[model samples]
Structure formats: C-alpha cells, structure tokens
Target: MAVHSSDYPFSAFPSPLTTSPKVPNPESQTPSPAAAAAAAHGGSAKKRKSGLIECQEPQGGGNSAGESSLDLISWLPDEVLGTVISLLPTKDGARTQAVSRRWRPLWRAAPLNLGASSDLTDQDQKRLVFVSKILSDHPGPARRFSLPCMRLRDRYAKINGWLRSQTLTGLEEIQFGYEIEDPLLHYPLPPSALRFAPTLRIAYFGYCDFPREMAPLLKFPCLKQLNLCGVIVLEDVLHSLLCGCPVLESLLLEGNVGVGCLRINSPTLRSIGISVSCYGTRVENPILLQDLIIEDAPCLERLLPLYPIRGPLTIRVVRAPKLEISGWLSDSITKLHIGTTVFQKMIALSLTTSMRSTVKVLALDTFGPNLDSVVDFLKCFPCLQKLYIKADLQKSRKNKWSYNPLDPIECLESHLRQVVVMKYWGMRPDVDFAKFFVLNAKVLKKMVFGCINNCNDNWMANQHRRLQLDNKASQGVEFKFRRGSCSISLTHSRHKQDDPFDSHIFADDA
Candidate 1:
C-alpha cells in the first residue's frame, strides 16, 4: 500500500537522449514498417525525431498487428487504462500524456485523486497551479482531494473557484485543513463545494469556521464519514448538519469550539467520537456542555469521548438496544475522568442494567492493577472478550480483592481472549497482577506488556523470568513486549473482532 514517487505510471518512459533508433538488421529477409521507415529516414535521422515519435511509431504496416506489437498496453480497454492511471498521484497521472497520444485521452478522463502536503517545498503555489491545470484542462470526475495543513490565505479564491467547478461532481472524499501555526486565521468553507458533490461520502475539515447562513443547505445525502477537527461551529448548526445526513455513520469532532452540547438521534449512526478542549482558550465564553443524549440510534456501536469532560456532564444512552462498545464509561460524573472509581461505577451500572451482556470491549486507565477490584470490575461484563488496560505500574500496590482459590470470574474462564497492557513497568504489583491472569483466565490467548519511558535489560529479563514461572491456564497464550520512547503496546493474539472506536487517550497526551 506504500506508494513511491518513482513508481508513477509513466515515470519509466525513456528520455530522448537515452532512446536509440531501432536498427533494421540488413541480414533479415523482411523488415518491419518502422524499420523500413527508419532505413528510409536513415538511423541518425530517426534518432533526431524525439523519443515519443520513435517509441510510438507503428511497426510493420500500422495495422492491428502493428499497433498490438508496438504498444500492447495501449490496446487495453479504456476502463482498465483509467483504473491504472487513477492509482497514481494527480501530477504523476497527468504526466502520462507524454507516454503516447493514446494515453493523453485516458489521462484526461481518469478519476482524479489530488493530494498536496504542507511539507512539500513551495507547495502552496505548486498546488494552486497543479489543481488549476488539472481542473481546467481535464474536466473529468474527481475521486478524492486532500490539502492538509496548507497556507490558504492567498489562494482561497482559486480553491473556492475549483470547488465550484463541475469537474468535482464525482468527488467521494475531501480533506482540507489550514496551517496549524496560524490559529487565529479561519477559512470558511464555500457552500457550493459540498452542495455540488452528491457523491461525497467522506469529508474532513480542520480550522474552518462554518457559515451559519448556509446551514439549511448543508445536506449531504451520501456522506457516511465526517470529521471536523479544530473547527468552530455552533451547536445548532452542527445539529442541523447532522440532521440532513440521514445515513451518517462515523463522526469525529475534536477540539471544536462552538458546540457545547451534542444530541444525536440518527438511527444509522454507529460510531461517534468527541474530544472537547478543556483549556478554554478558543471560545470567549465556551458553553459547559451539560448533556450528550443518544436517542433512537439502535445501531450505535462505539461512543468515544476522548478527553475528560470539564464541568458537570451527563451522558444518556436512550433507545440504543444494540449499543455495545463505550469508551471511558463511568457511573458518577467527577469531571468525567478515567480511574478505578470511574470503571467500578461503570461496571456496577452495567451489572444493574441489561447492558452487562451487550458490552463486550472495555478500555480503562488505572493507577495500578488491584486484583480484587479488577476481578469484581470484570465480573459485570458477562460477555467481555477484549480488555485494554493502561496502568502506571510504578504506583503503590494495593489488593482490593480477597484471594479465593475456589471462585473465579466467568469471563476469564470463557470469553476473554486478548489483553493489552500499556505503560507496564517491572514492579511487584505489575508482576503479581500479571501472574493472577497467567494462573487463571482459561480462554486467554495473548498478553502484551509495554514499557514506554523505561525499558532496561534487567527489568525486561526479571519480568520475563517472573511471568514464565507461573503456569498459564491457556497453553495458546503468547506474550509480546515493546519498549522505547513510544507507548508500550502488548497483545497476545489476533482476533477478527470489529473495534469501531480507536483509542486516542494515550495518543492525545503522548
């Protein structure tokens, strides 16, 4: 899936200086038309006529056989040709015209996938020209367009004009974001941009202010995935926008300023991610969003609120019978933070309700692994399969659960398959906690341990020796260890479970 710049469709074409004339062997009885033409024009004369002509000239008699022999790939169907060109970058795809006259038309009609990164030198000017030329000359359907973290102050008019063009009618995905350094600058999205593309399925915008006047016309009938990061928009405007997309599935709102409260009632919405800024720097008087009410969304699977909810926040899951995976769930709202208390409350609440059987995957951030508390916490989710625990092993060890040799948690003996422990240090509490799982958890397949900040050879060897001493209940269980400046990540085995919510708790802070 990694794309190399040198692997472009037409990048292999020989240069004029390197291309040698096809010399007709005088010993051969018969000569091809191209060879005959080369003889007639003289070898040196044919060499002087540019690489394109020399490479594309028909051999034999310019018939089907000649065309097939000269350029077999050109004989490929137009649909196939377009597909091949579409895989290349926009600039590279455009350069295919130099390959042959047959490719010129194919390149013109190929589905455009334009992407320009800010890291590229003179990217702003180059993007403007490149986009302008592609849109103006080709006038073909575009599939994806991305301009991430670019300076768009001077080129906004041109970008707006291009978005308004009819060539983008077939666009399915669009990602646009402004320069990160300029926080005060806000680029307003043109109404015509989204309005024209009924085929748009995914849209991501960053640092762009939503125009309130165009809220009514912001209907995206085919949009399924929408991500608005660092964008300023009112709660009502966001509600109106979501209301229009009857089939919106995945939504990610990160560091959005204006929206105080979020209410989602879409039956088609499956995954919702919200990360509100607690710094209180963006908006003058930011609303302390009180409630997040999910109504009538039976298909809702993943609900991830990444950061801690600043003020008194209430989350109510209503009419979502199929709601399964919820990130950072808590019973009592103590600034909506992640800890042992929050997890205890969540499990307790689930145990008291019908969500106990439905909830499968759980992610928690704990101070340290307390065996009793962990067992009691997990007992609530009867069908729990995957458990992600981020614990600081350096903290003090505490035993919350009374060790009972006869009794065991039902999940560990049955459903639990994978366990991922992050930020693991070679401490007594960490080893003891891990040993508890090793000697228990009949169905456990994999256990991963990661140490982010410190990973000395002594620490690793000691932990390995300690864990291996304990007889693992599951013979198939595998242990993985990763240590470096990056976050430590460990997983026992790979399962085909569908994880809708991507954990960003560590990612945001790390």
Candidate 2:
C-alpha cells in the first residue's frame, strides 16, 4: 500500500493554464463550485458569496473544483513541516528553505541528517572538508550520520573526527567503517566510536580491522541489535564484545568473521543471522566461520543463515531448545548438528539425531525443490507446521520425490499446515512437487504458490488441472496462486525493520 498526498503535484499557478484543473485521480469527478453556481443561480454572484462567505478566498489558483489553488503544504504547522524536511537527504532538506519564508528556518532547526556526499557539488572537493562544514553549520542533535567511503582512500581518523563532532553529541545509531560499493574499503575501528557505547541501540559497521586484546570492560549496554559484517575480530575480542552487550537481542555475522569456530552463550539474545559463501566465490583474504555452536542461549528463538553469499558455515546447536525457526538452509551449509543427528547437504546422514519437536517453522533455500531431502527433514522435525521453500531447477536435478503412498512422513500427514512455495516456475518438476501436498497433506490449511515462468491464463489452467486441487485431501484448504516470488532470505539489519520471517515482507529475495 502506498501513501497518498491530497495536494496537487503541479505548481499552483501556471501561464496559459486552462479552466479544466488537473485532477490526480482520473476516476474522481470534481465539480467547480463557482461554475455550478453560475448554471444553478443564473450567474448570481450575490447568492454564491452568501453561501460560502466563511470560506477563505483562494489566493492564487486551485484545481478545476473552484477551490483554493494553494499548495496546501504551507498551511502545515512548523513542527510538522520541519519533521518532513528533516527526514529528507541533507541536500534536499536544506534546499526546502527556498520554498518560502516559512520554510527557511525549518531545515536548520530540525534534527540533522548528515550524509557527507549530500550538498557537495564539486567532484574534487575533499570528503573531510565538506562533512566538516555541514557539522559546523548545523546545531547539535543528529539523527543519522552516513559517510560513504568511495575510492577516496581517506584515513580512519576522518571518521573519528566526525564521530567526535558536537553535531552528533547525543547520536545513537552509527553506520561507518565500510562501503558496500567498494568491497575492498577496509579500515581499523576508530577509538572515537566507543563514545556511544552507553547509548547506541542499533549499530552496523563492516570492513573493520579489529585490534587484538579488546579491554575486558568494553560494552554496549543499550544496544539491542548489532552487525559486524566483514569485521575480522579475533576470538577473544569477539567474546568481549558479546559479553559487553548484556541486553543484545540480535546479531548478524557476515564474512571475515576472523574465527574458525564461534561459541554463543547469551541470556538475552533471541535472533542470530549469518551470511556465508555458498557458491565458492573468491573473496580476497576472507576469514569466514565454519562452525557455530550455541552452547546456551535460553532466550534464543530464531537462528537464521539468511544467505550463502558470504562463505561456508556449519551450525551446531548445543542448548537452544527455545529455537523455533531456522533456515535459508542451502548447499553452503557443511553441517547442521542438532541433538545427535547430523544433516549435511540438505539430508540427514546420521539416524542417531533426535527429533526436533520444538522447531515449528522451517525455511529452505533449495536448488532442486527436492522433496526427498525434505522428507528426511520431516522425519527429524515431526512437529514442523509452517514450511517456506524457495526452489529452483538449475541444479540438484538428481534428487526426486520418491515417496510411496503406503509410507508417510510425519509432518506431511498431520503437523504441516501452511506451505509457501516461492519462485515456482510451473514446469513438470514443480507441478509434481506441489501436487504431492494436495494429495497427501491431510491436515493442510493453506498452500500459496508464487508462479512466474508459466503464469498466463492458459498456464494457470493447466497447473490447476495438473495439481488436482479438486481432490485435495484437506477438505477446506485455501489454495492460492499468484504471479510473483517470496523472500526466504533473512538479514539482521535496520534495512529490514520488520521480522525476517514475516510473510508480509516476502518478495523475490528468495
């Protein structure tokens, strides 16, 4: 759903403008009150004036409705308009002063949103100099400060100076040290950033050169969410960082983890997302984690490896019985050690692994949509209820759903209720995979298909007939088909503000 603005998009007054004012909605009918008055009262000006005397006269123009042609925005109070301007980029926000006299003081008075590149026109200008000027001009109390590190190759001290500036005195959220556009942009953690340790609630930084032997007392008491992407910190320093955040709830570790194996033992932590390399991309001097052992996370609920874009990772759960949802499980995973069972390459190899009755929601990022491997997972997770699968056909063509009708998987027969299949191209392989649930999932309540490759009217008809929806085992199951994809990927960041497992947030990222 998109927000709508009541004011017209065009300027209030225009030269050679016609009497027919522009109406934003083509379906809406806006009658000019003045024109109607002329027709109804036989051009009686006195009667129209008497009827609408209390209404303010439109100063300049309006739509063809014979109402005020005013911009309507100028009528908003200073605080409301200032807040809107404050949310804009620094360059655009400052330019709002040119709108009118009422807007001149709003930008400077409102909270500062300083992005160094904004408002700078000269390509040759030094990054530090331009950022410094903005800080010097704006008053204290910054909301968000972003410094993009391009090929300028600036020193870390530049960022240190910005963090120390008075403009960001009480600022809490900071994203610095690295730039995604320049993957090679690595910098050492500046000492100035520790100033916000007591106040920061959310923080993100990458490509940092962590100093050895972090002080025993370093901490972030207010931080609830943290991301150290590509920040290669040693095992001891990583331990100190986690210990300091006594209330930290979410953590994201991307590539360059700088540790071979990680042991987590947090009381308040609830969510953890790791992104590692799945396709063996050659990352320069990458130090990715191979093993993640949750020794004791009592409050943990979600353990997600959003994507395999970073490097290989193997997860072993030691004591997170509260862990309810986990995945984006793909080929990048070397092992998933839960209880006594060991799952490698999307299939359980060890029969000794105990059943995971606590795991209710499972997400799979599979290349083949291989139901045979999924059946093995069902045997391990008998109580699983919600399944989110993003299946592709480019690879893993060898595995097939070779289950016999006489035998049954525990999840398919009773527990599995809601199944969401993403990026489904209704080919023979996909049709067979989906039809399996329609015929076998006796307790199924809803099945959502996001089809793209073959989604025309005729294709949908063919899929409907092939799926045999009429004979679905679940009597009242809701079968929905739409032309799109869903997100099975999860990344812990402010960029994705909502819960990663939310169905409302899904779209093609899978």
CA displacement after TM-score superposition, residue 164 of candidate 2 (Å)? 1.9
lDDT of 1 by residue, 363-444 (tens): 6655566555456557756677887766656467764344464776778879888777766665678777877777777889
Give Cα distance to truth, residue 12, candidate 2, Å: 23
**Which lDDT value does model 2 have at 20?**
28
Model 1 segments more than 4 A misplaced: 1-72, 118-121, 180-182, 278-282, 288-291, 306-314, 323-350, 354-357, 370-373, 403-408, 452-469, 484-510
lDDT of each: 0.61, 0.66
Highest TM-score model number: 1
Candidate 1 TM-score, C-alpha based:
0.74
Error of 1 at 343 (Å): 5.4
On residues 1-510, what C-alpha lDDT tens digit does candidate 2 reach at each position? 221221211113223222322222222132222222233344334433443456654323333333333233433445555556556655555555544444456667877777664233334244455566678778857777765443335655666777898888766677765543454444567767667777788777766666665536677888898887767677777888888999999898776556777889999998888766411232455566778899999888888876754434578888887777877777668787887788887778885754466778888877678877777777788888888878876543543465566887788788899888888887777777788888888899989887776467788788889999999989979887766776445645422433355556333322
